[model samples]
Target: MAELSAPTGREPGLRAVPRPDGTMPRALVIGATGYLGGRLVPRLLAAGYAVRVLARAPERVRAFQWGDDVEVVEGAAAEAAAVRRAVADVDVVYYLVHSMAAGTGFEEADRRAAQTVADAAAAAGVGRIVYLGGLHPDDVPLSPHLRSRVEVGQILLDSGVPTLVLQAGVVIGSGSASFEMVRHLTDVLPYMPAPRWVRNRIQPIAVRDVLHYLLGAARVDPAVNRAVDIGGPDVLRYGQMMNGYAVVAGLRQRAIAALPVLTPRLASHWVNLVTPIPRSIARPLVESLQNDCVVKDDDVDALIPPPAAGLTPYRRAVALALGRVEADDVETSWRDAELSGVPSDPLPSDPDWAGRAVFTDARSARTPAPPDRLWAVVEGIGGENGWYSSPVLWALRGWMDRIVGGVGLARGRRSRRRLAVGDALDFWRVEAVEPGRLLRLRAEMKVPGLAWLELRVAPEGTGARYDQRAVFFPQGLAGRLYWLAVLPFHGFIFRGMANRITAAAARAS
Candidate 1:
């Protein structure tokens, strides 16, 4: 891969991806909306890369916190005109796109996409190309997913441009398909059956370390134009990984059975039933476990130095992923209590908040009441005062949460008419409050993801405008499904709450 010197005036004692001319490197990311691509773009920007993204739907890219930070070139990678436009004048290309979710003939689709990107990058004379692939044994027959990845990396390497293909296995992070699989399987079933591959060894790496190598790949020696193995320390069998997660999450050790009869397809179906991951994606991920996935050589280390803190161990990565829920950092992820700005102001406010799929619902109404009357109603919400909506729906949700061992609505608020940031209001925590303006509550109920409710009031035309928003960041597939199931109720819950609050305020005026 081509080497670029670090930008001038960099923080001392820190290595920056280098560009010889001391100018910012322009990078084109093909899968800028995926988990890896979403995380990589901001880091590339921090590392001094002028980023440009290629996507079929520009709105998806615009949804990212860094959406406005980079130039968006709209088009599918399969389209030559689109890929050509994205690659032009770009220094490096990050091929993080994979269509395993497309299912059935996803391999061919991946191949065509790779060929399109490779040709486009070569034609543009892109400085370097980086692609993340799976780590598998050399002698055995690779799974269809792994084979497709290998083929894609080879295509990029042979495109007449220097390419650095970093192969990793079982990335452990929140919302990651693999990590979510491990999480949900442990959380749902105390004893998991079947899947003889559970005994297979795996060298799972943390998402942070994966991103680390990706950033470092920018400075790999120009002659280094081949795939390298990247993994974390402490390799263990798949079952042991689950037990390790159990330890970190304060759960009992799980009983995992590796029965020979459980084929990959059957195992995937089982995983689909238990975890948030769907069968389509779970099949390939499960099939990958058919063989051990340990890194064979230290080729990656020879090119890019490991993180100074060293690779994150398996248990440590699990703890990092679970720490958010344990500490209620999900509430802190909102970035502030005032409910100012958009939902994704800094994209992810913290590393802990990364990898989640965010969903939101918002509504507004105008009331004849002044801002103070509206604020009074907003602040006096929850507790015995009720939510100014369907009490039956709220109570039913609360009862369900209680059944799941969550802190149910019985907690109520500290006061009937006032609140502070740390007060517990029923199944919610008062996160932030702006007197006569806004009140934001973080949901403490047991759900598959993090949720928040925001109430706002502003004076307008001798009246007041009341706005309400419900936001959620789903953990994984389960979380997505949970949101979908409740979406129909949102019109009744949040919309009714907004309207009722406005009506109450108008009557009080």
Candidate 2:
């Protein structure tokens, strides 16, 4: 394929068009699967740029709403050929990929990845590069993570590309690392024995503001190529930020005591135990918090004008993040980028059922209703609609889950009538959804083993056959004991559930 032409020194405000014979600037987004990158792609598309993404595992981002809109180049950033292909014929390249969560040797790996992209972009004659880096004062010693970001930014700038590096502190948005840390810390603990770093001043920027700056970078003049520091209007201690979040979330003010003895290692371990954030990523972030990260320059403000409504405040940003959680509209999460390191293929077909101690309770009932009716009844199984069979028993289970730090049943469904692949349905997440045919829910509730409840409807002689299967993959002796302990309840719950669903379908029919 012929390389797309770079953006000419054309008239300002001309949006890029994706035409075969037009001079539309093509923007390539590396790390499109990350939180900010995932959100930025849609904004770029709306701004009339033909966006393309480079991802290691394209399947991971296949669930994105804009997955089909952008072209995907499947390869790792470490590969020279892959980087060349990704940087090919692009007017601007957003280098948003980072490897901090890859455990050890991430700094060197990050530098190598940045160098590869920088060399590739230079070779491709790319017009410009936009990168988001950490905000840290030059006087203070930087943590390994923050230092790596600074190094990466310098590498891009030294590549002779007109690079616009935007340095930001904690991003206050749903699924952002900083926001998640604040959210989990505030929500889980009423009293915190935090480290001295919690008292350090930090200026957080809303994700919306960050995206606005990023989008505006594309329109920035090529001559204005330098690092710009951007942050929210509020500058407060990390503990105060958590307090503000609690206020917005309608939770009681949490009491936090600063302890000088608490090291970053201890804090990271505490975060790992309390929040979903792993120790590997949380350790660096915790260490970075020791230095104040409030922005010191207004260069970005001069380059990119503020949004129409102005920058969002910390409290409002917290409210917005919580609102997304409440509405179940979280666009992307930190968990999405955490690769499982295992193939996500479907369960094996024709498995040795006898070789493994797989326990399953399969129940089938012929319903007078059609498949659609049966499927509707199956789809509306949890949330406000209740479990159809035992409401009290389900509530008890949910309470148990909550006590154990599971999501429990409070999240509910995004829509009571509709279901999607990643939607939360009470204590279970919708793993697979097939309209009028099948719905598989993976249990998120606290349990000793992995469990799935699958419902399938098939055409019968005149109506449909409702099949409900409870499959459990035990881990060890504890898992087996757990199954045995719950064996009696399964007989009552599963059997009752199957009968009630069939009856409900019949009524609906």
Best by TM-score: 2
Clash count for candidate 2 is: 0
Give per-residue CA lDDT, model 2, range 1-509, as digits (tens): 11111111122332444446765678999988788887888777766788889987675456567788899998877889988988888989999977656656878988999999999999999888999998898877888888899999999999888999999888988777789899989999999999998899999999878887887788778786789899999999999999999989889999999999989888887776676565666777798798888888787777778776688899988888888777766776664443222123333333645677778999988889988888998888786787877777777887666554455565456455767565557667666777889888877666777778889999998899988898887879998998998888886788888899999999998
For candidate 2, the 10 contiguous residues with the lowest summed lDDT are 1-10
C-alpha lDDT score of every prediction, in listed order: 0.76, 0.79
**Which residue pairs collide, candidate 1?**
4-18, 4-19, 5-18, 5-19, 6-18, 276-478, 412-426
Give a tens-digit lDDT track for model 1, residues 197-290: 8888999998778888888887777777999999999899999999999999889999887799998887876765555354556778898899
Show where candidate 2 strays beyond 4 Å. Answer: 1-22, 340-509
Question: Model 1, stretches more than 4 Å misplaced?
Answer: 1-18, 325-509
